[model samples]
Target: MKKVFIILLFVAVSAFAANPDDLIGEKFIDVYGKDEKGKIVKLSDVAGKGKPVVVVYWAIGDVDTYKVLPEINKIGKKYKDKIILIAPLLSVSDDKEVKEAKKLLHFDFPVWLAGSDSIKAYSIEKVDVPYILFIDKDGTIRNIMVTARDLKKIEENIKNLIK
Candidate 1:
């Protein structure tokens, strides 16, 4: 019984010490496009008042996103008030491309048009359509999810930070 209690206490202490939610309180930001209708929406101001801000860097023309975006949309809606979900279309080829992609996505989340410089800063070299980054209310970068499965980890991280 003594040995078992010691082991249990050790486990609990380790669990409490290692918090992945430490990703919160870090600072990072990506420049997004504005106009409120295109691939990117530029942030005129920084951070938020109460809720965490989630900005996803995605290119609409990719088919992967077509299947995955709805999942993202679902999560976005679930935490809408708690999170500011913004998906910026990183590939801004032309007006026609932007228009077509928007028609297909029909996403409720705000789609911003981002320039190459902004995209490069994020180191988004791949065509991965569903990259999500969470910036906490105080302007700290909490977490980043580059795929749909990563959403679960991001969600869990958010719950910790929110409370």
Candidate 2:
């Protein structure tokens, strides 16, 4: 029994240690969501267009997630033509909620209503709010920021991928 317990502990630790770096260089999985006008949108449609993409996962009521919107907005504005920014609101289905969230957040980037498929695809089911994924122009995930609010570092990642 002790040996079995020790093996299980090792497995759990190994899984935990497999961090976001493991996902780097892997092709980003495509996700589908709805636009502000209830039109269906796919991640592939907007990304991989000869420009880097910044995907930010957020929710309406999550304060930490929405709190970073202003910073993200500034980044979006600064890199307006250089990068494509997508804000996917996880678990948010209603268009009314999306509109309200937009009004409250005041972000200029495109917002989408991300469903379970998107949440699961990104492996953020158990992660905290304000998760970010930086994908290069080739659609490969270059970096990931989980629950991190470092705007400068995020901007740096974007800058590195821009060219």
Candidate 3:
């Protein structure tokens, strides 16, 4: 019994130490929404396109996330040709809010007004502002970060995905 308990503990620790990338080899769930231009876009369209895609999930009220908007925008423009940046504003139910956000963010890439269906498709339950999804060219989600506090980590992930 003691040996079995030790083996179980080892197994648990091993599982915990497993890399996040190893867990998501399949294609990402398709998330659809209208961009600031009122044109529809789908994650499926960009995924597997031989370029990395960064999807930022944020809400108007998330102050921290809002603070990082400029940085995210910079990332988008800096890697425009190498990758795709998609910012999805959560909890926005109308076009008016999207307009306000668009004017405020001024992101060069697409700023999508993600409706309930888009949020549901991602299986997001809470308003974890600044939630980020790093997807590879193969349509696999390499990382899902719930906060934007550590920009270096995100940058590193982006570099890895592109490289």
What is the clash count of model 1?
11
Identify the leading candidate in terms of TM-score. 2
lDDT of 3 by residue, 89-144 (tens): 78655678766776786655667877676565555545567878889998888887
Ten contiguous residues minimizing lDDT sum, candidate 2: 120-129
The CA-based lDDT of model 3 is what? 0.76
The positional error of residue 52 in candidate 3, measured at the CA in angstroms, is 1.1
Error of 1 at 40 (Å): 8.7
lDDT per model vs. reference: 0.65, 0.83, 0.76
* Better candidate by lDDT, 1 or 3: 3
Regions of candidate 1 where Cα sits further than 4 Å from its true position: 1-25, 38-41, 44-48, 93-103
- Compare candidates 2 and 3 on TM-score and give the better one: 2
What is the per-residue lDDT of model 1 for residues 48-162, given as tens digits with 9 covering 90 to 100?
5566777777775567777666667777788877777776777655566656665666667766676676555555655545676677776677776665455577578667556
Off by over 4 Å in 3: 1-23, 93-96
Best-first order by TM-score = 2, 3, 1
Q: Identify the candidate with maximal lDDT.
A: 2
Which lDDT tens digits does candidate 2 get at residues 1-163?
A: 9999999999998787545678888988899998888899998997777788999988778878777887889988998888999988886468777777877888878888887877667677544568888999989999889885888898898898887
